[model samples]
Target: MKPSFTFSSNSIRLSYVSWICIFIVLLITISLLPIIWRGLEDFNPSDDYRLPYELSYDYWMFSCWCKYACSNYPIVMIGDSVVWGQYVGLKETLPYYLNELEKTNQNYPLCANLGVDGIHPSAMLGLIKYYGKSISNKHVILHLNLLWMSSKKHDLSDTEEFRFNHPRLVPQFYPKIPSYKAKFPQRANIIVERYVPFSSWVSHLRLNYYENMDIGNWTMQYPYRNPFNAITFQIPYPEDKPHSEPISWIERGMTKQDFPWVSIDESFQWDSFKKVIKLLQSRKNKVFVIIGPFNPYILTDESLNRYKAMKKDMENWLKNEGISYVSPSDLPNEFYADASHPLKVGYEMIAKELVETESFKNWLDK
Candidate 1:
C-alpha cells in the first residue's frame, strides 16, 4: 500500500500570496492605462500639486484667487469651468485678455474675472445680490451658458456634463458642495488630506508661474493623440444613444440651433429663465447678456428642421427681451476649445464682436 501525502500548510499560504500579488499587479496595470482604453489613469500635470484628489476643490480655490485678485479692479467675469479653462493659468485667462486689451487697445477699461467654475445660476443670483454691490455701476459681460437652461436648479453644475472628481478637498475648504455629495467617495478622497508628494505640490507651482501664459487649454491629452491647438463643443441633449466613447474636446465643431425651446406654460424651466433675467435686470450695472458659442450638437439634422420651423416663436419670446445678447454661431468653428468653450482665437472673435456692437459700445461709453 502507498502512503497518501496531504498538501503542506505552507503550500496553501503560498498560493494565497500569489493570488494577492496578482490582484495588486492588475490594479497597477489598470491605473496606468491611457484614457483611450477606458483605463483609470489621471492626466494631470506629472509633478504633483495633485492633492491625490484635489481637482474638485482646487477649481473653487481658483475662483477664490480671482476674488482676491479682482479686489483692485472694477469689471468682473462670472461663470463656470469654461471660465477656468481646466489646466490654464489665471493670467492667460479671459480676465487677463480683458486686462491686456485695455492696456493696449483699451477695450475693457478695468475688467476683472469674478468667474467661479461650477457655480450654480441660483447661486449666481445670490452672488450678484451680495458681492455685486461694487460692480453694479460697472458694465458686466455675462456669458449665459445654455447648459444652465437644461438644469433643474438652473445652476452650472446641474448641467449635462457635471463631474465631481475629488470630494476630499471639500471638507478642508468648500464644505457646502462637499456636504451635499457626502454619499460620494469620502474615505478615498481622505488620502489627499495627508502630505502631498513633493512632485505633486510643484505641479500647481509650475503652472501658476508658467513662463509664456498664452498656452491656455489645460484638459489637453498628449502622447496618443496629435498635439491639438484648440477644443470646441456644442450643447448636450438627453441622448437616446449611449456614449460610445469619451468626448473629443480638441475637435472643432458647430451647432445650428442652441437652447431648445421649452414652452413657459409647458414647464417651470421657462419661468426660472424669466427669474434669471429678472435677477440680471435687478442689478444696477449695465448687463451685456451674451449667448456664448456652442458646438453643432444643439441641432441634429432632424432638430434643425424643427428649429427652423419654430424660429419665429422662439425668437419672439427670448431674443426680443432688450438683452444685449449675441450668438457667435456666425463666427468660425476654430474659435472653440471644446463644445461651448471659446479658445484663444474664439475669445478674440468675441472681443471683436463686443467692440463692434452698439450695445457694448454704449456700455463702454458709460
Candidate 2:
C-alpha cells in the first residue's frame, strides 16, 4: 500500500537504457568499418568459394585478346563463364579485349562478350536477344554444354556448386560435389583462400607482373596470385572421347544398356534449344551456336549409347533449321582451361574459327 513508483521515474530509466544500447551499437559499427567494407565489396550472388576456372585470370585475359584482336566486325560471344571470365573486370575480359582488337585490325570486326558463368539452359538466348539489335553485322557465338543434356543422376541443383581453385559457382546454378575438398585439393582451395581485402599494406607494395609489352604508355600485365598458382586440368575434347561421362558413371552402374533395365529420362535438351533459337531469330538476329569442349567423363561408354539414341532426334529436328556450331574436339585440348573449361589458348582458337567461318563471312557482307 506504500510502494507506488511514479511513471516519470520509470520512463527516465527506459530512455537511459535505450540510449546506451544505441551508443554501443555505434561504437561496434565504427570499429568494424573495414570488415564491413570488405564484406560489402566481395559480395557475390554465387558461392564465391573459389574454383580454378573461376580464378584463372590468364584464361580470361586471353579471351580479351581475342576480342581486341577481332574488334572490327560486329562480334558477339555468348555462353557461360567460358565467355564471362568472372574473376576479371569486364574491360579486362573477352568483350573488352574484342573492342581493343577491332581497333588494331582493319580486317577484324567488333566483338562482344555476352557470356554469364553458371548460366546453362536459359541466359544464352538472352545474350542474342539483347545484343542482336545494338550493332551492325550481328554475329553471335554460343558455347553449348552437352552435359546439360545429361541425366538427373548428377542430382545437382540450381543452388549447388562444386569447388575449383575458387568456387566456380552461380546462383541457382549447379550442385557441388559434396566433400569436393577432401577429394580435390586444387578444387577445394576456396575452403581457405586468403581473402586479403584491399588494404594500405597491399597498396604500398609494388606488385606487377607483365605478359606482353604492347600497352604503349601503360604496360599489359598478366596479374597472377603469389601462392594461387594455376594448374592445368585435362578436359576431354569431343574427338578425344565420344562418351567419357557415361564410362565414368558406367563403373557405378550409371549405364542401363548392359543391364538392359535402364529407364531413360525421355527428355531431350535440344527441344528447349530450338525455342532459344527461335527467340533470337524472331528478333532478326542470327545465332551462332558455339559448342564447348566435352570432358572424358562427359562421353563414356554409357553416354555413347545415349548419344546414339539421341542423335537421330537432334538431326531430324535440324533438317529445316540453320544454326552455327563449333567443337573444341575440332581443335585441341591445349586451348581448354581445365578438364571441361576453355582458357586463353582456347579463346584464341575460338577467335580464329570465327574469323575464318562462313557465318562470319555472311555477317561481314550484311
Please give, for residues 1-366, the per-residue lDDT of candidate 1 as tens digits: 666986466643558888899999876654443212212212222111111122323332233334333454466566555554433344445555556656775533366555555544444543444334444455666765555443233322233433442323223233133123444355444433223322222233233322212234333323343223222111112122211222334443333543453333432333434455566567565566665555554456665444344433434565577666555554464445455566555565666666667766676676
Per-residue lDDT of model 2, residues 198-303, tens digit only: 2211211111121212233122244433322321222111121111122222333432322111122333234435656676566565666655554444345766
State TM-scores per candidate: 0.49, 0.43
Against the unseen true structure, what C-alpha lDDT does each candidate score? 0.44, 0.41
TM-score, structure 2 vs. true? 0.43
Residue 20 displacement (Å), model 1: 62
Misplaced by over 4 Å in model 2 are 1-73, 86-109, 123-137, 153-268, 296-298, 304-316, 331-335
